[model samples]
Target: MSYLTLFLTAFAAATLLPAYSEILLGTLASQDYPLFWLWFWATAGNTLGSVVNGIIGRQVDRFKDRRWFPVSETQLHKARNRFNRYGQWSLLLGWLPIGGDALTLVGGIMRVPWLNFVILVAIGKGLRYAFVIWVVLKAGAMAT
Candidate 1:
C-alpha cells in the first residue's frame, strides 16, 4: 500500500500536477522502509512519469498557437536555447523542482535526441529521488 501510494504520488508530481514527490518520498524514507524497494519504486515511477511528460509535450507542436497549453514550442525553444547554452549537463539538475520537468518537456518539444533526453532525464530524476532518500534518512521526520 505504501509503495503504491509513493508510486502514484511521484507519478502525478512528475506530470504537471504541482505535487511534491520529494516531500512524499522523504516522508516515506523517514519511515525506514526497505531502501532498495523505496528507491526502485520511486525511480521507476518518476522515470515513467517523465516519459508521460515527454509524450504530452510531443503533442505541443499540434497546439503551438494555444495560450493555455502551459508550454508551447516558442517557449520550449527559448528554454531549449538555454539548455543548449548550458550544455546537456543542465539535465543533471533537472530534478530540481523549479525547472525540472520544464526541461524534460522542453527537451521533447525541441526534439532533443530521444536517447539523450531519456538518459539525462533518468539521471536527473534518479538523483532527485536519491537525494530525497538521503534527506529523509538524515533529517526528515520519522514516520510513526
Candidate 2:
C-alpha cells in the first residue's frame, strides 16, 4: 500500500499537477522500504505521466491558436526554439521543476520521437529518484 501510494504520487507529480513526490519518496526511503523498488516504481510512474503530457502536447497544437489556450504562442515558440537549439539532449533535463514539464510538453508539440522521449525521460527521472534516495539514506546514517 505504501509503495502504491508513492507510485501514484510520483505519477501525479510528473504531470502538470503541482504535487511533489520527493517528500513521500524521502519518507519511504528513510523507513527502509527496499530502495530499488521504491526508485523503480517512482521513476516508472513519473515517466508514464510525462508520456501523458507529451500526448497532450501532441493534441494541444490544434487548440493552441485560441485566445484562451493554456499555453500562448510565445511560450510555445520559445520552448520550441530552446528544444531545437539544445536538440533531444534537452529531454535529459525533464526531471527539473517548472522547466522540466514544459520540455516534455514541447517534445510532444515538436513531434519528437517517442523512443527518444521515453528513454531520456526514464533516465532523467530515474537518476533523480536515485539521488533522492541516496540523500535520505545518507541523512539517516548521519542521524545515527
Candidate 3:
C-alpha cells in the first residue's frame, strides 16, 4: 500500500477506533518502502488523530456535569483527581496501547494547553513509530 494508505491507517488506529497501523507499517517496511517517509506519515497521522481526541474531550467537558451525560459525576471527579495527581506528564503516554486514546481524551477534558498537548502527543507518537521502524529495519537486516 501507498504512504497515504498507511497514513489513513495510522490516523484511524490512533483514535478510539479499532485499527492497527503498526502491522501495516511492518508489512510496508518489509516490502522495502522508504523508512523515513513511512515513519513521518504514520507519526503525523497518529498525532493528528490524538489531537482530534483532545478536541472531542474538550467538547465532552462541556456536557460532563449534565444529569443525562454519559459519564457519571463520580467518574468525572475521579478522572479529574487522577489527572491532578499525574499532572500533564501523563500525556506522554499517549503512544501506549489501549489507554493512550483515553489519556489524550482526558488531556482535552482537563483543558491541557493545546500547544503542550500537541507537543507531547507528537513526541509520544513519533517515538512509537520510530521504534516500530527501527525494529522492522533490524529484523530485515537479520533476515538478510
What are the lDDT figures for the candidates, one per model? 0.75, 0.91, 0.90
**Which stretches in model 2 have alpha-carbon errors above 4 Å?**
none
Q: Residue 17 lDDT in model 3?
A: 90
Go through the candidates in order and give the clash count of each. 0, 0, 0
At residue 51, what lDDT does model 1 achieve?
A: 75
Candidate 3 TM-score, C-alpha based: 0.93
TM-scores for every predicted model: 0.81, 0.95, 0.93
Which structure among the candidates has the greatest TM-score? 2
lDDT of 2: 0.91
Write candidate 3's Cα lDDT for 35-134 as tens digits: 8899999999999999999999899867877878888878878887888898889998999997899899889989999999999999999999989988
- For this target, which candidate reaches the highest lDDT against the unseen true structure? 2
Q: Please give, for residues 30-137, the per-residue lDDT of candidate 1 as tens digits.
A: 676897788888877877787777777677879877777666566667876887787666656657777778766766666666677678877878877887787776
Taking all chains together, the TM-score of candidate 1 against the true structure is: 0.81
| lDDT accuracy of residue 134 in candidate 1 | 79
Model 1 spans > 4 angstroms off: 66-76, 140-144
For model 3, state the Cα shift of residue 123 in Å. 0.4
Candidates sorted by TM-score, best first: 2, 3, 1
